[model samples]
Target chain A: MDSIEHQDHPDRELLEMLQEAEAKVEQLRVELDRRREFRRQMRADEAHEGTDEEVERLSEYLEQAQINWQAVRKFFQSAIEEYRADDAWGSGRPGA
Target chain B: MSQTIRDESTDSEHGVRQIEVDGADTAAPASPLRRLPLTGRPLRIVEWLAVVAAIYVMITAVGAIGSGFEAATGGQAEELFSFASNPFVALVIGILATALTQSSSTTTSIVVGMVAGGLPIEIAIPMLMGANVGTTMTSTLVSLGAASDREQFRRAFSAASVHDMFNLLAVAILLPIELIFGVLGTIADWFAQLTTGTDGGIVTTIFTAFGDAVSAVTSPGADLIEAAVMGILPEVIGGVLMILLGIALILLIIKFIANMLKSLLVGRAERIFHAAIGRGPISGIGSGALITVMVQSSSTTTSLTVPMAASGKFSLWQIYPFTVGANIGTTMTAMIAAFGFSGVEGTAAMTAAAVHLIYNLFSATIIFAVPFLRPLPVKGAKWLGDLGAKNKMYVLFWLGGLFIVLPAVLIGVSTWVF
Candidate 1:
């Protein structure tokens, strides 16, 4: 909703933050939905990063004592995971 | 099933360390240069056979050490081990021995054997506690492996060092109380006696039968080794030789067995962690204990958590309970090794083993149950990790200084002082 409509609301400040560049209530709604979708995509990427294949790979690295490489690669993988999430948000659709 | 676990790091792109894996290749791990024993069905069987042989060697090693000490000391065991008479010195010995071998199971097994042979119970207890502290070194180093990647190194170091903090805290809390009150030993002694029974009875008979079964398998090898050594040298020298041989066998055989078991069981461990890590602390602890038992090393258990922690998938608090479970799990080896002796010696060996188990359980229970104590390890690890990212030198000091150099210095100073 517009900042004017939420003047007496408990989350008025939050609405105003979202409405900073947008004037109409419809535009504010789209902004909130977009943010929500972005968060959902980030969570999905996190789950994918923790998949069984990755666990298997991590376990093998550790068992073989390639610990330094494991840590470094996983660091790279974390950056990649976050990057994918951000990329999806920028493209306006995941896997675009 | 031959598994391609590691492809060596090469500069595929200028800045990247492309140490990739083929998920398609499934089964076992081999080092970069060697084929290892994971090649096929027959080889897997051979690997398992080697693991079984390692257990036998481990048992006989404990026995050989016990009997070897008996021969060398000629009933002067206390005088021979007089250096460890100081509890602090004994503690340092435990730390140094375990740190050197990188396996607390080996150190504790030897300690149990020594205790059975006549090392003072009081001296052995501190050494056992020190083993717990020393065992954290390998995983802590695993965390330090990421020194070039500061953020990952910091978080990974925190995850790895949490175990170090917990064990250090446990020793700090328990050692003084243990020295003064003899709380752990009293319970252990009572339990040992109750199970073994000084007087002839059904319980004692059953215990004797079981001990005989164990001794029957181990003593022949130990006696044969002792006799061979004795034939080549004087009794005292042979005893010393046997002690060295036993220590070497325990160390080398354990590493060999650990590698094979890791190859065979890493899949199970990975599966368990995936299923259990997010479930809560108890699930984390139980899975940690289970995997350590399966793979036969707490270092393996804790080391497996490092990459996950570094990746930021699991927080340090989530990893803490698992490492705590690992401390408890490693006592299983010592308990099995205790069976190397039978009759009265067996009772003492078992008693020392019991003390190791009880101490871990008691420490874990006390730390977890007390609200104030629970967060100490996680907090301490986080602090060290934050520091480690900024100053790599401090990480070296913590790893080498606390685990090795500090213990050695204490032992040296104690020798001159007391």
Candidate 2:
């Protein structure tokens, strides 16, 4: 009796197709949510990396403080004028 | 007879030849590139003989000074060198004398002789340290040659000043200990006692034999000179004149020997120096000391490194140990000078010489072994070199401040303020 009844229904196939489409939409929505979360994590990692670079820059600046680079540069400016390149004595100097 | 011959010929090794003109414009052909003279067997023999002669004269001169000093003061020599009794004055004298002569070996050897002639051991000890400090002046001067190029001058000056810094720091540390504890004098005397036989050491026999042989060869000349001077002038005046003559002879002969030896040993020494560089600090120091001993001049040993430093062949740290080694090697001259004396005089002289050796070795051992202390000289030198490279005025100020004004100020303080 039941078999005869089901076989008689005209919209039964269409209803099954609609159910499959809804399941696919839920799967797609979960994937989109994962991608958005991953994007946020990557941005956080980039910000942390930038901080490290800033720390290194500051350390370098501090090291330069120990020696008066301004004075050294100023002196080099004048010294370069008087500096001469003479190989009069080099590696061949006797009494080595 | 000339031992060296000159020739104008092509040298494939150096590709050095006379310049040529394209068309017979013949402006006197440029002087041919000539090679340094090659040494023959006869020349080697002559060189060795000259070396022996120099040593003979040097020892003879030392003896003359000792006897002359004794006679002049009538065995009460305390007052004669009284001004130098203050350790600071003695130190300044050592620095000034060594700087002017450009030879610490000469200064240290003279100090040994003066000690043998009754200069108080306390005074001689500081002078020995000063002589070590003063020897660095030679390399500093050599580095000035590269002053035209900022980088080269910086490197050269740093290399050279590492030596000066190490020595000056050593003095700053040791002199105070030396003053308060007098440890150098005590240790020096102990060794002196070993050679002099007060402690029954077998070295006494060897030391005596060496001294006797030296006396036999050198005494006649010294005696004849003393007798001739004494014959005409009063004993005191003759003594003074003999002392002056002895000093003159020592200065002249030492210069001659240094020049001769430098010419002979330079190539061999250069090879040794190359082999040792970059090996480590120990090898650097060892080769430095060895080359200095071979050529008999610490100045020559240290000056050669200035060029290498400027050329970037080695770092300042690498050359630092070598300079220290030169300091060690130069102590040999004082030891040799000490051997020419015997008895109480011998003991005093030997103690002074030993102090020179001990002070250098001890300072080197302490500074190099300590991780923190090792870089002190290098850092100080780098700072100074950087400053010097920036302005020529700094270099002049350094020369004046460290060598002249500082020592002068110390002398004044030691003499009057104290």
Candidate 3:
């Protein structure tokens, strides 16, 4: 009679385990949101610290740096994209 | 409960897919670097056409001078060169004409033509020697650009003047031997005979073709100019005009070509010189030969090297082989001149040119191959450079005396006494 009762109660334990996992996932999502907001505020503060001329010059330099980085990133990303596209096409599937 | 679980799994998968799509879209745009559709500038076409036009103008100018010479001489071209019968006078004329024109080719071609037209080889040989000496003046003149900077001027002038010293030394050593023993002349004549089956040889054949082509273009205009000027001004006036025009054309061509080359090859040339200097004398000689060949003039090669030397990019030792190589390279003009005449006369003229080439080659072989002879010119040049550094006026005097005053005095005395 005791064995029969243990078998019938298995679904309850499974539900409790799922609830615990969902709670952990929610905590992780909140941490990620805080990190993103902190990064955005730091960037805004940096953008506000200079006199107009100095700010303009800094902005120009930052823009150029950004452009260069973007160019480099684009080059690598495009290469990867090309490889993936080629592989997918070669496999005769839409997103292989 | 199973349905709820399935919905949650699907939602997470959809979120992950959304994030990936967003990341892909945010990955910066493809490289803005595109291959420029236009491979070369349009101005290149204009530059090439300009070069072609300049060449045509140069040929025309040369034609004009030939016509003027024919008109001035009035079929007495042979009589006109009678003064060159004296070897010393011929040598002086060679030096003066080349100095005035600033071109060894012009002087050499004239000498070859004169020789082919019945001027004695003995007379032409001296002229050939004079052309060798006179060619050095171009670099000497080039040194003047650095005159404002005393230290630079001293170095540049010395480098430029060293060529004059070398040529003078060669002439001093070889000329007396040539006059007394006829060693160079004999050897040259023998070689000429072997190659051309006559003293004037194959070079004369080429010169004849050149002369004919020149005559065909210029004779009609020359005849008309002669007819117009014969009564009003002396025939000499027309000749003078021709000479002037020829000179102007040559100067213009040289200036343009030099600027073009400097713009095109100066960076590469600097690198090459730096590398060649480290490789030693053989490399130096090869560099000198190659640069002169590309420039089509040894004076240009030597003159260009002076500035590099002045700037301390090269030492006197490195430059020595270059000068020797230039001496050999310059004789190519005379060979080209030989092609302008035909028959026995052309052969003789070509032989004279060959003599010039052989003389330089032999001198290089003797000086460079043997350790003893190599340092003489270098030592002399350094000594002169030291003197030039102390008294800047010495540069002018050296040029004036060696290329001008001395040659003129020697020729005048020879003419008077002989």
Candidate 4:
């Protein structure tokens, strides 16, 4: 049944959908990285601006953002791992 | 059973879970935006408070001085003039007292009050000159703070001591001329006549009112305290307390006033001075006058330049003209004080103040305008500063000779010879 589902659909259409989804994810990841880099640059600029008070505030914001991003990244990675494990278990069922 | 449950939960059938995860990811970017703190609001409040407190403290301190004086002197304010009967003695006393106290304003105010109370202008004039000399002690003592650093101490000490040397020079040249020719007295009298006609005016009225108000508050309290202590302690203790209170009040008020003025106007004043100092003799004189008027004491105005000098921020040469300006500025106090007196005494007081002004103007013109005399104090101060740097004992000796021993010797000689 899995083979039929894989073969009945045109390979090109399936590949295109997967490629489109991956392209969107890659674009978003790049945007996120660009923004992170921009933020880092902004922090560096703020440091050179010679205002201790301003630099302190910017540093604190950067730290909180870093912590939130780490938690989100971990959440997504764990969810992906759980989905993969369930797919394997379902595929290996004795009835199949 | 657990595998089938997990598969069901992870399957595409759970569309709500995917939507929630997507929503959470989308919201992650907004958290960074929420983190900035508010700035400048608290600092603004603090600055305003400082200004208000400074003004209040200054007024209270001035009021306290007046009160202390009234309490201590009572109806015997006239007796204060007895000390100034001998001009030389008055001069020495002014110098000694100011040196000990380290404030010209205190010495000048006391002298002004005594003059208003009936001290001769001639006697008070010399005392004013002494006060000018006496005020130099503060910066000299300040220089001692830098003593551990040799070069810094030398620079600071010289910068500090130069004020003393200049005043001494002024006194040396002018005193004899005044004694013989009565030059200062004559000039002062002429100015006094020209301005107030017969002497006494608005200045006296205002000061009297202010002094009366101060005395009203402090006198009763002081009298009660003195009465309470009469049998318990020597009468001299009351007298001492009165004097101390006067000194303390004056010092505290002047400090508050200085702080207020500094906070309110120093930045602008400094800019004005910098511009003026660069503009040749006229500008230098103008800058010095403005600073003195603003600060209200030439000693305070002139001494302001000393630390800058010692720090190598500006040279002694640049500051010399400003010092001349300060000399003129200091005379304003006496001039104002003169207005508080009337008739011949007022004329005398005004004249004395005028003499101080004229003498300084004349001295600056003669000493500073001519390149030859300009370097004298600088050279003398440098020599003494070098001596001080080499042996810290010289610093002590300088203090003793200028402030204590010399004044004592002069007083002794005047007593014996006159």
Candidate 5:
């Protein structure tokens, strides 16, 4: 019985990574859009003017969304790098 | 830093992933009663029985406290509250009485009884308003129990104070208007007129009969205790002892009732709240009101939200309308007591009760219905909770100042100045 089920296949791994990254990116984008819309609505509602606490809360939310976006971007970039490396190896290792 | 990831629970079988369900985790041995299956039913039945017992004990305790107050004051509560001719004094009296007893239902019910017994409606009205303010203190005190953990305290305190802030804000807006315009009084008078006909009314008949029955059962014990205490101690001290006993009984009984009810209904409460969230604020308020009416305690209903809020299951906004509903629901006790009166006194009692109901209804409508005003209590409570989280002294100061020191000073000043 083999302990290791399979060897690393960068092409397959990169494909899965791309799917995960795509979902993360979508989620982050939705969250950022939601926060931005909420902040914009708050600004429109002049009744809550001068409430620094609300402002701080919205800022914290925006910061979180930005952090999520950065992580998603990083994941996408790594997925692209893995895909490129796999393509190069596949071309270089030809049957003689 | 590097981290290793593992998915050991998943296994490859025939090139397909297989996941384990662990059926053993869900199975439990059954009892010998195969013909009848009872799961969690017996425990729930016992909890509900305890809940009823706790409520009866609480009612008896409130009766004891009211009787003690009357006995201790030598029926001088009217004289003590005479300075309440100044609405603020009466309001302060209401706050102190409810804070001391820790039940607005008790305080407002007492006010209703007093009004029936010939206490002026004007004085009783302010006291009733004070009860609304004072009752919030119980949940606020309950929230303080979470103070060891700053974050928990912050969330719980905010959840608790939202109720306090709403009531205080309501009083701020309504009390002056009440004093000048007499709008609540007029509305209550109309309600009283509408209900005064038809053989003392169904609500009144039920409440009066309930009140008499409760008194009959509890008064002898209270009187016996009163007589015994007076035999050893001074008359005033004996009265004071009764008051202290009543307060202790109320706190203990309410605590037990809340725990029992929570045990029995938490899952149901969570479901109700979840459903309320989907249905919007009206449904949330209705659930809050309904629960409070069932349990006969707004403090219990509101306090239940603290742990939920602290655990992040609910937000301040979601619980805000529910707490408002608690305010509306709590009026039922006072309203029920009002019906115990007959003739002019009955009219006065019902009037006072109507004032309580109208006050909560008007406050909820005016504050929550107006988009501009809706968020003030929530915002105010959040700020206070944030401040208190940073420094706990603020919590102590709020409890002491609003419930104790301030009420004491106002009452003293009113007595001296008025």
Candidate 6:
């Protein structure tokens, strides 16, 4: 069956929640990529200056971004998992 | 039958797909010589032969220095090096010489030759200790490359400084013990006697014969080279010219040998680093010693760890034993140079080389055995690195004080005043 057809089943709310969680995951992925690219550029720029302070600042920024990414990723993962569980329960087929 | 958790063939999978890209012969593409049949084996043999030749050249260069020193000073080199009578001054000379040259192997080899030429064994002992301390500067210098990145610098510097701290600590503990007890020196004398044998014994005769052959072949060419250099320079500078030429030859030959050995053994080195270094300290020490002995350069071996540590693939503790092993391994050059002399000179030279080996062995046994003492170098290195990360100037100060300022000041004072 098409994913859209599955979305229209009795557990429509759970399916919609799943769709939203997926969108959030994609968004986070894009954000992570952008952050990584920005950090890469910052590193390249800091290399030319070759100062310790700029390098330290860049390191701190990357660490904070990693924490933010982990939090967002964990949130979306739980949301998607919960949607899957509810939809399965409502359909009366736990394995499916 | 067991079911797979993730199947890459499935088109609907949403998680990161397992891309099946072949590993692409990424292991440094084989050269044209390697691609050719039969020629590759011959080339490998030639490389090994070249390594042997390099060692021979190094030994001849060391012998040249000894002979040159004797020629330069007219049998009075001993009086000039009399300042080395003081252990502290001698130690400083060793450290300064090694730091300046960037190779303890070269420094110790030169020291061995000097001893054979007439530098006192007691004086050479402290210099040997200094060489150990001086060699650690190479890795510390390498760690400076990571300074631009704070975290990397922290890891790299700590990794690098553990070598420094360990050697310093070793000298701090052992040098005094040596000064008071002469324990290491006495044992070295015993060992040197056993191995070198009497003047007419087999070992001495063999060494004497070999020395004769080497001198016969190299002395003429060496005299010619000295004459050519002296022709341009004044008569006053002839001795200095020959000594400098010998040292330059030593450094160049060693660099060439180390590079050749690295290329020859890089694959084995990779396997050893990956599989053996992480197993335990014993394995790590073994691998470290093995690689250093293979390359004939502890600087090459220890400086190698800075990048690995900087990448965060390895920790300072893991690299610590390897550094210790490097300390032990670098004694091989001096040991080999010991044979270049005959009779009493050979015995004295061998004694100095033995001192180097015994000192490292004793230091490794004592420091690594005591759990409390074991972590001191690692902790001290980390602390210094942490401070360096906050302010890069701390590392600069450390490098300057330990390697440059301290050695330079000590050497100057020792030369004129001592």
Per-structure clash totals for the candidates: 0, 2, 13, 1, 1, 0
Cα distance off (Å), candidate 4, residue B23: 46
DockQ of each: 0.09, 0.02, 0.01, 0.01, 0.01, 0.01
lDDT of 2 by residue, B1-418 (tens): 0111222233334423221221211111111112334234444566667888888888878777777777777777777778877888888888888988788988887778778877788888888898888888777777776655768988988888998899988998888899899888899888888876456557877777777687777879888888989889998899888888888888887767765665445434544654564457888788889888876778877776676677664678767888999999888877877777777888888998999999988899888988898999999999998887655657767877879998989998888966
Docking class of 1: incorrect
Candidate 5: give the clashing pairs.
B204-B339
Model 5 spans > 4 angstroms off: A1-96, B1-80, B198-268, B339-345, B408-418
Which pairs of residues collide in model 1? none
Model 4 stretches with alpha carbons more than 4 Å out: A1-96, B1-84, B199-249, B336-349
Number of the top candidate by DockQ?
1
Worst 10-residue lDDT window for candidate 4 chain B reads B1-10
Q: What are the runs in model 6 whose C-alpha is more than 4 Å off?
A: A1-96, B1-39, B199-237, B408-418
Q: Which one wins on TM-score?
A: 1
lDDT top scorer: 1
Poorly placed runs, candidate 2 (over 4 Å): A1-96, B1-39, B198-200
Pairs in clash, predicted candidate 2: A83-B148, A84-B148
Residue lDDT tens for model 3, A9-31: 65767766788899999999999
> Which docking class does model 4 fall in?
incorrect
> Chain B of model 3: TM-score?
0.70
Tens-place lDDT per residue, model 4, B287-397, is 877877665666566656555555554556566667767777766655544444444444444555666678778777767666767788889888998886655556767
- 10 residues in a row with least lDDT, candidate 2 chain B: B24-33
lDDT of 4 at B316: 62
CAPRI accuracy category, model 2: incorrect
The 0-to-1 C-alpha lDDT of every candidate, in the order given, reads 0.77, 0.72, 0.59, 0.57, 0.66, 0.71
List the lowest-lDDT window of 10 residues for candidate 3 chain B. Answer: B1-10
Rank list by TM-score: 1, 2, 6, 5, 3, 4
Deviation from native of the Cα of residue B78 in model 4, angstroms: 8.9
